[model samples]
Target: MSNAINVKRAAVASLMDQLRADVTEKKLTPQEELAILEKLKVYGRTVAGSDAIYSSEGIIFLAEVASRPDNPDSSREALRCLANALYLDRQTVQYFIDAGYVEKASEAYKSENVDDEFLLGRILFFSTTFSKDDKLLDKWVNEHHLVENNIAAIARHATAYATAASTASSQAVSMMQTMALQDTLKLLYTLTTKLPDVSTTLGPTIPHLLSLLSSIPLQSSPLQPPTHHVLDALSNIPPTTPDSQASYFPTSDPTLHVSKILKILDKAAIPATSATSSRSTTADDFDSRAASLLKLLIEIYPPSPDVVKQLIRDTLLPSEKERSLPLGSQNSATLPARLLRLASSPTTTNTRIILQTLLFVISDEDPVKFVKNVGYGHASGYLMMRGIPIPSEALEEIAAESGEEGGSGKRINPITGQYLDDELKAMEASNVKGLEGMTDEEKEQEAEKLFVLFERLNRTGVINVENPVRTAMQEGRFEEIKSDNEDSDDDDNEAGKGKGKAKA
Candidate 1:
């Protein structure tokens, strides 16, 4: 290890000496500088080597080299080394911050070359992540217009990549361009997450990002980096106005944008069920984010186009076949059923809340409509959790109100959200379990448990209703009984006395 360190130190020293000579003599070509930076880049991958680079003032050298516009290739390579160094050794970011790296890097961020923008954007992003200096971020956005440049970078690369992806057959070039776009997005995410107000300026990025979603195919793990990153970035910056948001979708095919996003949401949230299928917490988070973004698209102020709203409704709501089964049945085969399953899962809390909120928005946030759409079985939990009072009319089927059918003829099973015909069949099944075989004690225990649950729900003030147990007692429907523990203690005492008397 010592010998290796010695060798690395000597190599770093020689490279630094050559860099200094070339800066003064101007003899080494841009290719030579790149060669040197490539070597430095490898060395900086470890802490000891990073310390070697920092010790020899290689950061300042790299920063100065990256600042040179005439040597764009060499400058980009230099920036890559600096970015790697900052990432490998986080403490080195303070050194870069002190050297005004953000200021220097921000100037080169708008380069027409995609590679330059990618490397510099990453460097700036790293500074934001690792630097303790709070004002550094302020300087990046408030002073340097980092948000605007990133937006432009995203649009430019997205268009270029989309065009290339469509026309070019080379997967390598497409992958590189894809990576460049992803880095710009990551930087933008850091900026927006830190100062969410910056999202207001992010209006220009929406259309490009939406377009990229179609061009970029999601991997087997649907919520992988670029796709998920795009979803998340879009979520952070929905347009403030209906017209503005509407304009972001293609005028020729408005459903195109919404459809592309919805496809990803379904793919991620509703994984294919096979022997090989696996689910991860990360994917759940991604799907939740996608759901939230879809909600934003659906609930835009002043309303989206009727066609767009109808498209979302058609895509997300229960189909006729799905309506034959319970709204969130385990065997139900539909996107809405799958999403409802996710929303009610114990492990996927965020996904549950997001999907529920998405459905609620689709229902116009009316309690009655929400229940009618998803059935009282699924809607009750979300409504109670959100403290929204369940509407009395939502719990039972109503005769079709005048002119309400609008040509869509179906009678809803108010409890299951299924068609009334199927619900009747299910109710007629004799195999349905009930309390018939339970002992008296067991039935009492079950009743007590239900009473406790209602009491707790009432205490939360989530709903205003008398506890059923209290009402039952007041109505003389239940009789007071000794506590089970007290009865057990008395039995034990009698047994003990019987044993003592036998011994006497």
Candidate 2:
């Protein structure tokens, strides 16, 4: 097997050397170049072939062939080969950069030919994806002014495609145009994330991004390709000033941007779950990106109209039936219920925090209303995590109003935000499997479990609290007992070892 692989590699190396020599001597014809490029393109699709190309300076050869003005067909093929090579073997990226090929490629963005534009965009996208050097990105943004010169024009061209896409059937829009737009957005997102200040100088890119977001037809999945890239790029480029933020929306429809974001969020929330597996990472990405964009818009919108707030309330907050249901029992069919479920999830931390914060904002940032609206069961953890104090008067008012009629004559259970009868039924169901049958040892084990849980919570900065079991032990609340394994346990502890079970 090894001998066969070595022979194949040798043949590939000889071919790469021949291509490099022909390109260097300017002796390769257009037809010959096309045939060699087809082979190079195939070779670049694998790691070993890409490595051979890089070692033989095949990237430089491909770039030279692609830059030949008279051989447009060969140039396109060469660009494809280079793109494949750079993508498959990221080590070729720095080599391409050091060879001054990126600047040459950027100049081609001025060409009216659509194929050249898309191919060059793909190449540039790979450069951004693979290169970690911030100096190069900074030079491209500030010194070269790539954003003003190339990126903005690319956005305009893409915007035209997106606008055309919005009105026409999906098949009518050119796939090449869509791909070019996706690559351009990916390039814009990577650059802005590295140097966010460049977003401020991105002349017409912001509107163009928004246009694409609004125009891009969501497939069976809302988080696919250009839509995902557009949202990601927009979130990283937030408005620098309050006035600038407000300027994005019209006064007549102040909630325009918020409405658009919620539409996406609504779709995203429908499928999100705390039990998401690795296969569902795309759903998680949508939730996180959409939540981030929503948070940015909410933070920037002026407080006057209250229209955006009202719109959010109508869309994301609890429905009429949900307003009366216990938060723990709320159906996940509604957006607010799904968000409430996600807000308590440990895995989706960013989505959780943003959901809680957005909920608080729509509640007028009042502790009492926040608790009253979502119930103490749902609101307490977030309030404690954020260190937002619940006023004594507010708590007292909530307690006083807990069992009120509220026009429905249904007495509310303030802790879980359920009606009194509903809470009683749930309590009865839980007690059917009560802990009364447990032995003293089992009870002690449960207490130790609680102690470990509190210790872990305190350690993680989720909450600050003393272990009640530890405090009880210190207060001499328990009698001591000896264990047969005590000596071995002590030896293990001294050796910095422990079993699967945690010590209290």
Candidate 3:
């Protein structure tokens, strides 16, 4: 028995040396390091020692190994160990945090390898939220003092995950993408919420955020990864703070337009998805958060008067489904068209909030311009749905004199859209451009191109744009629509518990 014990101790010593070399210096391959880790894990469970992975040096080696730039596979393995230690040994974890391991891992998280990205993000998630060394984070931010926010590390990984999710072929890849996204969001949320003063990180993070949001599917299921956190971080960020300045609307021309982002949000919130392919709960949370951000954005940057026509052109007219509808039909199916759709629906109170935003944006232009361009029916109907009173001045222009007394200035019929003859004529005149000479198939194709116009010229609804009434319809009246993927919330809660559970 004594001879057998001596042999096992010798083997353990050799394995420990290998592990130490792997962490202290880049002397071992990824495979070698993993093998050592496995051996140490098995031995450490059976025997307690001052130099084992459960000790201070063990954590130091793991943190150093995690931030390695040469071998991401090894780095990821090391990160997993550190994250486990995050919940196991607070004294060791704090020593690591104070040594700046959290920030170093954060910077390394920008790794091109998706696996490395996931692990690094997990490190940030636990370290910032669970370990939560605020002093370390503050000092780290000061050390890497950026003149501008350079969150490219996290941003690149975020964009990479989104891009990969689009082309993922296998279920494993899909799951990885899901995890990568959720982990990144969690880390970002923790940073913004816990260290709101860390503006250097958030500055470069904004553009990538917009890019990611622009790519999300509309109507995501609530079971998907809670995407709402992104919006929460954005909405909570102080706009004037230095950290907030990086995301601020450019003061100069060619700036990030309010209408531009609104259009992106419009597409994301309502993106057409195939019926068979299910949306996850995280996606639904994202949509909710996105809508909230949209509310904040609309409040800060209502569409610019200079770009009003462009907003209508890009968002309402040329979108995918809107194209198939007749120009008259297209009019009522647009962004403005949907505003009426939502406001009239009993399902949500976002209507009141959305209505006020639309009113403020369109308020800059004359109603007649909208009537002639988008058709009086669509524009007027949307105003009516929001309970805003129609302006008599604009109404007079669309309604021809009945010439009969008490004929209540000819209201457009709501169902058939019949009333705006003059506006329809004007719309058709501009619409008939290429068809001035084409015929047969040529005219057919030309007509298809003109799908950008409203569905029907004849339509009825209130024409009110002046001094609109604003109300937050969802306020106290609505609850979030629940999703079928409630298990995800349970799973996430379980994961959170893993972080806060008692140390070993």
Candidate 4:
């Protein structure tokens, strides 16, 4: 037993030495570091004195490691060390915080000399695991002027740490809880306003802010205005901008700010109406803010089909009066039409929502004719079902028109051999003997054949209906079939019961 104990102790010591060496020299791969971390876990649980020595050594090693040039491989190992140290010895972590090692790590963070992933992991460990000795943080902050000298740095570090923690293992929760809400919020507020300054810096901060917004505990009294302040700031930046717009909004690159803003909105709970009167006051302000951002998006980026669809859906099927709009008047039509034109243009890719919106409009009147003339295929069925009057006169006139003298004036139906009226008129004016010899019956037969062929061509494939009429018909028929089958089953059961009773 003594021999076995000695062997285990030696193994633990060996692992600790390796961990220390790796942390100091930055020589370990992330994989090797992870192996060492696993061994530390075992040593932490099974070996005597392992926790004490590891915690002390781990802190020193992390401080040393963080000071090195940025290397993802080495930093990953450093993060593993910080995580283990925080998990194993909270008291030791406080020692580091008290001894000003935390401030040193923070300085490395600001220098942009450390790997972000490692710095994030280290800060997270410090923030969450350091004992609640306010003196430690206060002393460090006062001595280093943390809030004054490095407010931006602190915010950047906190945001990056929070975001990275969120994506890390489940251990991140405890790490996040270590932060003071007031301090964190204040830092976040400062960072949020400086988003335009740090647009390029916003990528890492966004996830962190979103996470903070999600984790913030709602309170009833002394309304938290800072929460709203952060939200408003995020909502102000447009998702898309010209390539020359800003460094953050690189012309060739997609802006992440848009996604970050969307995420913030998704995660934030609307403040309760009864919680404060200010909540009600800000409702319009929130919409106005959102609209401003959206307007910038419209101006800078062509509206996506999904976005256009959403606008149409919201406008047409608004849950509140604020969402709906009258589409009849010209002014009322402006937003929808602009969207439709953008969606309908050949130059535009992905125009499904634009087609849907136009279909809704065409379901009423002359819009159907307009869509057909423009060669849009997705809106046809809706227009047809809504009994949109296709202007036959206009169609005939268009068919009769000739482009130029040298051009073939005759517009022959591709599906049928019938010439358009314009074509026939041109032929007649040219006094073509072949057309003059045709009898009225022949002309009538040709017209009927042309109508059948054109109609079939329009329905089956040739003319692209914006929304195919057959699709609507098929859906209606399927529903009808299902209902009829259910009714038939019911009728059969009733008849069977009646026969059984009569026989009895």
User: Highest lDDT: which candidate?
Assistant: 1
What is the descending lDDT order?
A: 1, 2, 3, 4
The residue-by-residue lDDT of candidate 3 on 339-409, one tens digit each, is: 43333333334433464344345444445434433344456655555565545445333332356432234
Please give the RMSD of candidate 1 to the true structure. Answer: 8.2
Q: What is the lDDT of residue 30 in candidate 1?
A: 79
Q: For candidate 1, give the lDDT of residue 134.
A: 68
Model 2 per-residue lDDT tens digits across residues 1-504: 667667657766776777778756978777886787787677667766345666537677778878989988878988987887777677788889888787777667556566776788778878866777778876766655556555665566656756577668666557876677777777777677667555466535666666666666655566667777777777666655444455456576777666766777767754444354442655566556656555654554434356766777777666546644576453546777777776776656557777788788887888877876677778878888778865433332133342553335455655676666665666667773223545556655565565666566667765454555555566666444444354454333322211122223
Query: TM-scores, in order shown?
Result: 0.77, 0.74, 0.45, 0.29
If the candidates were sorted by their TM-score against the true structure, best first, what order would they fall in?
Answer: 1, 2, 3, 4
Candidate 3 yields a Cα-based lDDT of 0.49
Minimum summed lDDT over a 10-residue window in model 2 is located at 494-503
Model 4, residue pairs in steric clash: 243-251, 377-465, 377-466, 378-466, 378-467, 379-466, 379-467, 400-422
Per-residue error (Å), model 4, residue 161: 16
lDDT score, candidate 3, position 259: 53
Local distance difference test, each candidate: 0.70, 0.65, 0.49, 0.42
